[model samples]
Target chain A: MKVLPYFVILPLAGSFLVIFIDSVLKDRKVRDTVADILANVIMLTLFILTLTLFGQSCSYFVGGWRPPFGINFLLDGLSHLMLVAVNLIALLSGIFSINYMSQYTARRHYWALFLLMLTGMNGVLLSGDFFNLFVFLEIASVASYALVGFGTEAEELEASFKYMVMGAVASSLVLMAVAVLYSRFGILNMSYISAAMPGESFDWLLKFSLFLFITAFSIKGALVPFHAWLPDAHPSAPAPVSAMLSGVLIETIGIYALTRVIFNVFSYKSILLANLGVISMMVGVLLALGQTDIKRLLAYSSISQVGYIVLGLGLGTPLGIFGALFHLINHSIFKSLLFLNSGSVFYRLKTRDLNSMGGLNKVMPVTGATSLVASLSISGLPPFNGFFSKLIIIIACVQSGHPVLAVWAVIGSVLTLAYFMKVQKLAFFGKLKEINKEIKESPFFMSASVIILAALCLATSFILLPGVRNKILTPAVNAVLNPTNYRMMVYIK
Target chain B: MKREEKNRAPTTELNGMSEIVKTVCNWIAGFIFLFGCYITAYGHLTPGGGFAGGVILAASFILIVLSFGKDKISPLLPRKRAEMIEAAGGLIFIFTVWTAIYAGASFCGNFIFKKWSCANFKLLSAGFIPLLNIAIALKVMAGLFLVFFVLSITRVILEGEKLKMVKEE
Candidate 1:
């Protein structure tokens, strides 16, 4: 419990250390190796450390100052789930980057920025107050802006600029919301704010701040209305960076932060969340179906999938919350897997256009097979992780007397299947293109990262069983179900 | 604006500003730096803490760069060295945070000079606050310098591009 600070410290230290090593070392090879090894080690350590907090919850106060006087890192079931997901995806992305980033220069700076992104994510996950959350969100956002333009090409720079502009807008909105909340409640600690919220009736200032919070986070999560930046930004980054941005970054800074604010801080429920979720689901898939670029297609799908999570969380039922949290993890695994697979394809072919690829499975069996698993899982095929979560979401929808919404959810699943099937057929199943005849499998690390994530895609479904659900999913659901308990986080230690 | 001016010889005229600017910068930069250090050192007791002081420190370096040019500053504080200092500043801050644990307090707890009387207004009385301030100042100073250096070089590149466009025209 006392080691909570390490979640923030380790990645931050690694980020700085990589910069130091890059500046000091004369040889590019040694510096790249040192940076790569240092980043992966820190990520792996954080991942393993998160695994230790599976069933326990605690709060650690920074500088030994008790809240609401000092900043704290709260590790409850919700944060535990987010921490595990973020660190696991970050480790895999780091491994994938080791091989994927060689074509780019300044590899050490890549590692430094990548680790800084992780630091921001970890800090965001652990932060106990609104201000700390905003700070961490900015850290992650700024690092990601640089990374999206890491290629320094024209398109990448333009995409980064667009993303930065939108991100800054979202950040300012978030700050405004935090200021509103602080001004109204006279507190910054989420628990303190939540403790005070129930005593007063809904005020106009509170309503305005809540509105800002929803809009800002929806933008970060790349829901339908604010999703213009995602397609450009996701494809422009280096592949590992794309994986992190789509699979982890949006979920943490966007959805997770929104959830904490809404469910834990305000404990308010509205039909608007569910409606927006449905819109994003339909619009995202519709947009994705027309894309020829592999990464862009996946980016659109991320928006649609996030819609499912929001819809579930919006239902405010235990089953709905469980489904949302489950799908959130499942999406992180398979989405990152799919992105890494696309990276592998780009690695071998030097092109992201799906039409240019054909019979790739014959040349890169590992990439093809993992890509297939991820695609199927994402499309909600039976026995894969996505199927269970999506099914749970539908069932919860119907049980909540929204059978029409459940049908719409099913329609969304079918559409997801349709596009991915198009991807698998056009890119991997046709005759090998003449230019791609000499293509080979991706490097070991890249392939290994995808294979591991693909296996997780299948393995994670087992958590849906009764015994496993008791240990993992139940606590998270309970955490969502009872916002009052979150107020105790500040009082506990 | 002429091609010849664009490709001027590598001498004093090409490298730096006028003698008046250089003289004024030389006279003022050191005092600004000293004031920044004073602010950082006494940050815990004053309104101008690490961030304000650090901006002042960076302003001093930026003033020197503007007056004396890249060649003058590169020999003293190269970009690589500035980057290293920034990273070192961050590392030292983390080190201090962890050292508090080794000294038998929680992470970032005020382990150094914890037993000192808080009623006194002295330099070293605010144990780790000043240390944290110094670290922050170092990071902000170097980081700002690096940003300015990068922007300045980029402007030079833009100028070259503009010259090429003129030649093409």
Candidate 2:
């Protein structure tokens, strides 16, 4: 409970501290090395901090102010899980970027912004008040917008601009929804809001706010109908930025925020979630099918995979919640691995266009092997973590009397394989192109980052073991399945 | 008529506005900046907080840049110094919150002194809100100035240099 504020404080402090070091230390070598070490250590510490919070649910009020009157921080089962996933991936990406970002200038700014985004994610996850959540959400989103265009190319600039505009509009709508809720209930605390909010007494204004939240958060999340900005923004960023964006950013800022609000606050949006999930599942896969750019394909696949999590959660059963949370973990791991792999390939070949290369397996064997691990994991093959989560979601669907939704999900999974197979064949296999003969593997850190994630792809399957599931995944599922537990803990005063 | 029109074409005392605008700006900007500090210092007890006071402080710098060109204004505080100051502000703000937790309070919990009645309508009484406001004001002043300077100076270099070239041509 006491350590909750460090989640935001450390990252915010680290960002400006790096700036101070960079400006003070004239030597470029020393500056970069110090900043790199500083960032990685901070992220690793944050990851460890999240791990400690498991099964030890807690709440903290800022400035010693009590809830409903002062901003509060709540760490329950769901947040702890997401906190670990986000920080773990953030550390991996930070390590990957040490080498990957050297190609670009303003390396100081990049590291600073990366930590700022990390701070935003951590704060968004930790905050129990809606107002503070929105503020942290903006911190993460704004940092990402700047990072997306860090390369400063015309396309990168344009994509970041597009992301910024739509993001601002979405933020406005979310704020408006928050305002309506606050006006209705006279408070913005999640526990207080849930306590006061119920279908029996809720008026049309509440319903309108719910729609505003769902639609706005969907746009933020890049769901099918509101996903136009992602394909451009994700692929346009530098590789590790792309990895962070697709791997954790979308989930934390978009999916996690939306689900938490819908499940805990609104308490009955399952039908809306179910329909949106099916549509995104279908649309994302279809759109991903024709993408030739490696990162763009991965970006679209992120949308499709998110659909699966949403579908599971929308089932509103304990098993379904478990499936959703499990899939969320699997996606963050494997998707990050795939994106970092793409970044490594881009680092060597300086391109994301799939058709420009061939038979990279003969030369860059590490990239080949690791990407294979990631691809199979994402495709839901056996022994990998993704397979079990996909299986659980499908089983949950069938058990919940949603046979048709199960079929659609299975179809989506099959489509996932088809597109990934296309990617592997075109980008990593086939005849070796003359232009790519001298291609080499990535720097040491880049290789290590992907290897770590690929290993995690296999490692996360252990969470399925009966004992381990009870320890990790079960509590997260329980937090969402029963909001009353959260209310009692947060408002126990 | 042509000579009278030429006299009002907005050319300056060399590179900036007329001497009157520059002189008036020099006096009033200091007052505005001081008032901004006043707001930030008393933010906990007053209506104006960090954000409002920050904009006001930034406006003073913007005013200086507007009347006097880049040359006259930036020499007082270089761009790099401005950035370092901004970074320092951020660090100070974090430092306050970090210390609060170490003082046996939660994160961002005010634990400096007299935690109970510290904020009881006193200027220096509020544990850290006033200091946080000052930090924010510093960052905003530097950042807002940096943005104005960069944009305005870029125009000067791009257009002024081009215009000089045109005159030579």
Candidate 3:
């Protein structure tokens, strides 16, 4: 049996299983334990399956039907890379949630929603049809909106409401675009759309559809102007959830989908590249500098980091694309680590307010130390993963003869360092507050997750080693750069 | 049931011109709501769909709330029943989509009775479209009812307590 579909099927099955078991168990400790372990095992298995599929291209048609007439689940180098990132982070988030969610009343409901989210992310990463992608995206987005509101505190509900409204609007816009595409192309399969493209007129309607798609995706991705919802939504969820949102959710669904649609379906438009890239990069950092809430600050930084990735992608060189993919992987690692670390702080401190915190390193060694590593890594310091990706992006920018963009990239990195350093100084480095003297380190599972992600932050730079790069990033980059090959592979088979 | 006594006297004021106006308003609201229902059910046939139809149905519920007040509407559909109906609607929508998978079509492929034909373009003619419309209507009506019911009850509870406290003071 092919293992590819299991990545999505298992999580979807697990979500139902969790709901069913939880309803019977009535929130028993044993049931929660079983659910947590089951979720972790499922994600770990998916991680292994993703690794197995690396460098091996495969596609599964739903209900045993062939493509163009059936919905296809395509697994290639890019998807494999995404699957690994998504599952690895999901696994760690599951681990983190075991301890982090203990304070909440509805443990089973949390796991159910989390699994549903996992199913959505997995489906989005693997879906080969536009409509399938949209549906899965909604599944994930709706789940995330609920998760953000899970706390039901005043701010949490407000944030969730805002997120739901914006997300709903984005979904409607995406659906409108999908309807246009379906009517125009008459086939929902992505590969078929590209194959049928040459003779089709790129009329006003098609262009309008493209514009709608980009606008909707930009909102989902939290790119600058359309990003009002991120700072509020990301910070309100539980720490593990916040980590997932910042780490992988935006990148996978928002950036990855946008890249796929723009490059693959619509073909790359240079005007889209320069205009969107420059504006997002400038606005993302400038806004990030003004935030005081640690998680909210980190959320803005996420916008900035995404800006860097988009800028690299916009450059449209082989090097630029390579850098973009590298940055994407690296950002997922360190940023998730940072968000999880922030969760650790919130776990102990019980407050996300930076001003209220002071010199916690003395009390919480693991959290303080891991956070520092994440901070430095994110700020593009050497020997950490962030530096290599940012360096590559800058090099790509310079090589592309956009000196101004390279300068902005460097400035953004410096701005990232400045804010993270402020976070360190206020929250960890100074004298311990008397009120926080009783504060303790988070539970073992939380610490363990942070350590693992922090280790990845330091170690992922090795992926740039030619063998490692070829084994992983190259195939993904090649997949994006060569959309024609994708068409031929799917159609010829 | 004990609370019903307190509301009985106020409902007596719903008489004469007020009663006629209320009935007419309810009829109009119900008509507009049923129109929304038709649009949602025939969405796959025409332009309006589950969402548009759902919104229209909700508007009808809102209109009923505005014209007749909460007590009058509450007896017709209680909170729990509304919640259950909404849940059922959601289930129906999901089930309808899932059927496509079993039929060897992709999920949500509009595969009721196979082959996309317009022969049944009328109200009863569209295969799953009418069912979808009914599902959306249930979801919308129940969802709106729940929201309005909760809001109304909370308002009464809080205000009643406040009035009682003022009397004591």
Candidate 4:
């Protein structure tokens, strides 16, 4: 249905509408109400469409032309899953931002940029062509660069500049790869490339392109070595923006593209994928342990959590794929919740320095409690979503006969717990400082977003139940496990 | 400060030959600017694309500013307006893609309003590819121009203010 594209279109439209309304409308109340209602409505519509599209395979041929030639928008289980996660987080962030962004100048521009970011994420999820995906990725990246520099402080500018340079490099690499693919395959559509890849062996050009793609995607995903920009950039952005960056942007665009390239384009090789996975997992956690800034710590942790997803996907087993997808969803929820909690802390206390914050729990119950839940969830405590996903991944590693990898996974989890526990002790549990004595709870909208996300953090663990798991995770895993099916389904011209 | 001003007199006279070199560099820069425009216009059919073409044009404009000064560039295209034009160019690119969808094609799918299958002899018959190149050229030129212009102005303003302070002291 046309509704498929509207998932991206509506937010983009909302972005412009917010700008228009804010400029024309004089009253702050009217502007706020309009922006709030519009963003919520747009995200709700996307969430509904994602649900409606679930369990069904749909393709939108741009200009009604058939595939292998025309650009196509394919919605299978994987895209559907990512769509739900991205929009849900965007909705929560919009709710959080309603009050939070008021403290900043140019609230309208903030909303505009936020919606554009959502548009970019959704576009990346739904795109079926490489070039289209790159364009949308740039859209999201450029918007994020500006958002990261939104504060206009010296550190923020420095972070933004560094991020822009790295991100631009990544984008250029992706573009070059796409160019090579186009010249080699004589086609730009992914399905076309996948279909054409099997019978023929690619020369060094193709291999070099693959190397570039992997390097670029890994940089975007913030795997350990290429991760310098992340610590600075994530913490430098405004909190809601930080939440979105850490939550879904890396997963959907970076890991998702890498997975698509590995599984569909190049053919999955278990050993290579697994090696990358284990290295990223260990290295990410090791780096994360040294960070003291709250957001920077979470940023490192985001890289490590992404490693878990990759480790699962690289296992190339049904259970592994299921675990990876489940963990992907769970991470989006809790990580965003954690960042939102941090946003709240920044809101009331006016600083992100963890050393400056102490005993905030008594004063800001919603933030403290929600962040506690998020901390436990991220550390893989039981009954929360993270525990089940991590368990599935570790079990998958063991079942796949990589017990050593499983051990490493366990070590990573322990490190995760230790660091987050350190965060809890330092930021939320110590003696209340006189400087923070006057700290109050965040605004109502902000608290509401956190509470909703906290509930999701607990409730999503039930997605591991058999019925729900089969309905959601099975189709997605099937999409990856059977890339041939994807080709057959779309190339029906 | 007075001593530095006095020191400047001999240096300015001693560097008169360098100023002549700078003037020659400026004219060469202007010629390079025209060359870049030619490359951008023909990018779709050749090796260069909007991005490369835009950067080249911006570089040429920037060389002129470097050799001369911002005051000369400002009157031709005010810095603020150039920034606005960059944003507008980006918008135009997005709008063009969306317009294709509105016109019954997918986003960025080029729809020929009228198609003429010409014998392969005419460059004028290149269809929508030429238009796409032009749109990209405009966007890239504006974007790079704004970025360079902003950087140059900021340097001039900040350094000029510092020099003024030194003089006052």
- Best model number under DockQ: 1
A485 in model 3: Cα distance from truth in Å? 1.8
**Model 1 lDDT per residue over B1-169, tens place:** 2113333332222267899999999999999999999999889887888888888999999998889977788887898999999999899999999888778778889898675646567887788888889999999999999888876654222343342111110
TM-score of chain A of each: 0.99, 0.98, 0.97, 0.97
For residue B109, give model 4's deviation from the true position in Å: 6.5
Predicted structure with the largest lDDT when compared to the true one:
1
Go through the candidates in order and give each one's C-alpha lDDT.
0.89, 0.86, 0.80, 0.80
* Model 3 error, position A379 (Å): 0.6
Ranking by lDDT: 1, 2, 3, 4
- What interface RMSD do all candidates show, one decimal each? 7.7, 11.8, 9.6, 10.2
lDDT of 2 by residue, B2-46 (tens): 112112222223267899999999999999989998888888888
**What does the i-RMS of model 4 come to?**
10.2
Ranking by TM-score: 1, 2, 4, 3
Candidate 2 wrong stretches, greater than 4 Å: A199-201, B1-14, B113-122, B153-169
Number of clashes recorded per candidate:
0, 0, 0, 1
Which ranges of candidate 3 are over 4 A from the true structure?
A199-201, B1-169
For all the predictions, what are the DockQ values? 0.38, 0.30, 0.08, 0.11
Between the candidate structures 2 and 3, which one is better when assessed by lDDT? 2
Writing each residue's lDDT as its tens digit, candidate 3 over A1-493 gives 2565676667876765665555455347888898888888888888878777767886776655778888778877888888899999999989998998877766766887898888899999888999999999999999999999887655787899999999999899999999998898898898888777653457887888888888898899888789899999999999889888888999888889888887777765563564476677677777777777999988988888888888888888889888888989888888888888888888787788899999999999999999999899989999998899889989988898898888988888898888899999999999888899999888999999999988888789899999999999999888888878767656432
* Tens-digit lDDT track of model 4 for A286-392: 88788778888888889889889989988988889889999999999999999999999988877877898889987998898999999999999998999999999
How close to the true structure is residue B67 of candidate 3, measured as C-alpha lDDT? 76
Q: Write the per-residue lDDT of candidate 3 for residues B1-169, one digit (tens) a residue.
A: 1112233212123212367768888679869878887778778779888778887877877677677765566676655456557656766766676666667655555676466554656665666767877787777777776676555443222343242111100
